[model samples]
Target: MLNRRQLITSLALSATVLALPAPGLAQPAPTTRIVVPFAAGGPIDVTARILAEAVKGTLGTVIVENRPGAGGNIGVGAVAKAAPDGLTLGIATTASHGINPWLFSKLPYDPAKDFAAVTQMLRVPNVLVMNADAAQRLNINSLADLITYAKANPAKLNYGSGGTGSAGHLAGEMFKNQAGIFALHIPYNGGNPAQLGLLSGQVDFNFDNLATAAPNIRSGKLKALAVTTTQRAAAMPDVPAISDTLPGFEIDTWWGLVVPAGTPVETVRKLNAAFTEALRSPEVKARFATLMAEPAPSTPEQFDAFMARERTKYERVVKLSGAKVD
Candidate 1:
């Protein structure tokens, strides 16, 4: 019923109002991706999923994607090449960040240069476990006993590890150097095989992840000599640390959150805040306990420094062990 001019004016005002966003309403956040460089259901993937859930309130919508391959190079490389908008992040690990730089001659991504460390998520201590029967047969009841036996026997005592350049292999190399014992190195296809070999007495001992070795240790199939962490693991408080006898001897699996290097400092700080908060939560603590992992959240500066030290340590171990993937 209005005149043409009035109708036009009303229509224009209505369009303008529709175009403006509501005063208090916020736009939906884009989904953030945590690229886990491992297969689904593995420890790293599980950790990423847990973190994704923990940070949901702060990060809005976060998802975990598994892009495992090439000893985590493919997935990590994907993160390295991703747009530095903080939308894509990575779960960088000891393997990807610490050892791979030296192990793989032609690494797909530069661990130090391509990513900004947000915070260290957790550490999974590796235990030196001997087959129960072998331990009993050799009279090796503790780390001291094993080191003494190896020193006396020299190259006669053999240890199995997850391939030549694996974390286990590097840990073994460090152990030999620190303990001054000579044990033959037997490389297996992977961790499972290495553990299997140790269980069957194919090898005398193994530097195995605490989570996978805990059940066997409880069942008396494997005798835990010591954890490789500087301190004893919470899940197995009775066990001693290798560092207890060989001070400065520390080799453990660890992982943390990282974003592309070019991401703005503001975005990096925001991510670090969210992830460190999640790592400090009691729910995350309990969940990590179930995995036999210890949360080790740290500031961006601390994480970068930690990674630098880790890489330097691995450089020595890898060279001494002569481990190569090229």
Candidate 2:
């Protein structure tokens, strides 16, 4: 009943309708929850917020949830029990994945079995910082100088840490073991207090997170002797690494993303891609610089392997230090 042009128009309309996706067939928008297993204001929480902001464009409705307590086990356990639909993810730190297993007598979730690695997010170096005045008095300008002074004074020099078995505590112990030097260890309730002790000269030095100590170091309140990492930190390139003096000495905190195990491989890949891309973006990189951290994106497989190595390393350190908690 129609002319040739009209018939062709009808056919085209039919084809277009057929090509359109059905309402229920289209993919629904995803709401992802990123759980941080630490207090809200700490480095891990800040990193989570930054990552949430960075990936919002690619992954819709990203949110960061803070669950602090029991040295990060409580929140991490919640993530382990989360639905493996890729909607629930968590930030895994060296403390959570590497240290806690050995530090604690029991954990609600197994770090190795409960979650699948999404990607490694960042790495933050620890710096050995001393009171500027104390360093000046001791004539200590480098790790070698610090070592020389500590060796000469044996137990006269004392270090402070957030607590027993913390990264700082372990780092100090490791240094003692590696350098064959002895110094007293003073534990504070938290890193801030430990750093305060260092500033007040209550303690001789601290293995402080570079981000937290950068301002003080810049302000000349604290003198950075060496970064705990084997390599110098980008945030403080002028500071040498402790390994330069004591070979094989390295201790730094790192964070990564993980999802509950049994998450679809495709979903994990998508998450890895989104986060890695976000980490690679200039804005995120700049922000990490401010935090004295480096964006270290990696594949799921790579992250898994890295965590395994970290666990083994921390186990040895914990054993060596005899650090244990209930």
Among all candidates shown, the one with the greatest TM-score: 1
lDDT of 1 at 149: 84
Residue pairs clashing, model 2: none
TM-score of every prediction relative to native: 0.93, 0.91
Model 2 C-alpha lDDT versus the unseen true structure: 0.93
Q: Give the C-alpha miss distance for residue 115 in model 1, angstroms.
A: 1.0
RMSD in order of candidates: 2.9, 6.9
lDDT, candidate 2, 1-326, per-residue tens = 99999999999999999988887785758789999988898778888999999998899889999888898999999999999999999988899999999999999899999999999999999999999999999999888998888889888898999999999999999999999899888999999999999999999999999999999999999999999988999889999999998888889999999999999999999999999999999999998888889999999999999999999999999999899999
Once model 2 is optimally superposed onto the true structure by TM-score, how far is the C-alpha of residue 174 displaced, in angstroms? 0.6
Runs in model 2 deviating more than 4 A are: 1-28
* Model 1 misplacement above 4 A: 1-24
lDDT of 1 by residue, 199-289 (tens): 9999999999999999999999999999999888989999999989999889999999999999999999999999999999999999999
TM-score, candidate 2, is 0.91
